[model samples]
Target: MAIELETETADGDDFVVYNHVAPPLSELDMQVIKSVPPGGNWADIPLSIAQKSKRIMQIRKSGGRTTYYGRLRNDLPSYTVSTYFYRPGNGSFVHPEQDRMISVREAARLQSFFDEHRFLGPASSQYKQVGNAVPPLLGRAVGVTIPSGFAVDLFCGAGGLSHGLR
Candidate 1:
């Protein structure tokens, strides 16, 4: 079930494709995405503009602190993927350059899932599954102690551990 992806690289188009698909962004989502600058978040927006949202207004009025409505820098690792990643206010889920939320495939890659690892269910469900996953690198490190040829994953969701075990 591996899908080939054609990505343009410095050399040329990379022919490696990933099986993962991302959920599409809505028009409002696109609008919200365009409002963010690279490595910026809703916090960077003018107070007048952000105040339209009750959530932002309440947070500001309460004098509470939050890293929500932020963006990830291209040079840095992503914030912990949360189940609510569909909302930009939940975390820095926006693409560094693209004006949209990070795709399911991107999230999977961040979690160290192989390109061939496929997720089941709807897009939102896929995001939740990926967000709740243990990083494959950590899984590999933990798997090193298991007896050769015998491995078990107690809470495998998207096969991060099982993939690493292989």
Candidate 2:
């Protein structure tokens, strides 16, 4: 989705704004976006052209493979866009296409984490961190209920809730 900025002539006022309606995704992209499996890969598509076409092999080798789980940002155009995917397992060295899991960066993006957010540790650790994160958007929405005087996070994961509250 795209957003536009508008200004008023009478007051010479500047304010950020948005359209009341959003453009729709292309039908094919919508189909692909809808078909994503929970904890599974696009390869799980039974009749997908990606699965049936011989090009699957080429894409596996060249384009490589990644999962495209939906992101919370789908609901908020002003937020950074992101999505997530899970890998098959913890094994370190699997074929690019057969890796069975999505990368940490991919998972972070799925959670609307910005490209500049630095994740710590190796790939496996990064994936673990991403998997454990709470969507900051959700946290912010929830933070509104906290009392103004003092707030406490209970069983918060990775301080995502705290970060949002602050």
Note the clash tally of each candidate. 3, 11
lDDT of 2 by residue, 62-92 (tens): 6444432222222333222222223221111
- For model 2, the stretches where C-alpha displacement exceeds 4 angstroms are 1-86, 89-101, 150-166
lDDT by residue (63-163, candidate 1, tens digit) is 54445666668888788887776677677887777666667777888889876687878777887888999989989998897888885676489757567
- Candidate 2 lDDT for residue 38: 41
Highest TM-score model number: 1
lDDT of 1: 0.70
How many angstroms is residue 123 displaced in model 1 relative to the true structure, after the best TM-score fit?
1.5
Model 2, residue 111: C-alpha shift (Å): 1.1
Candidate achieving the largest lDDT: 1
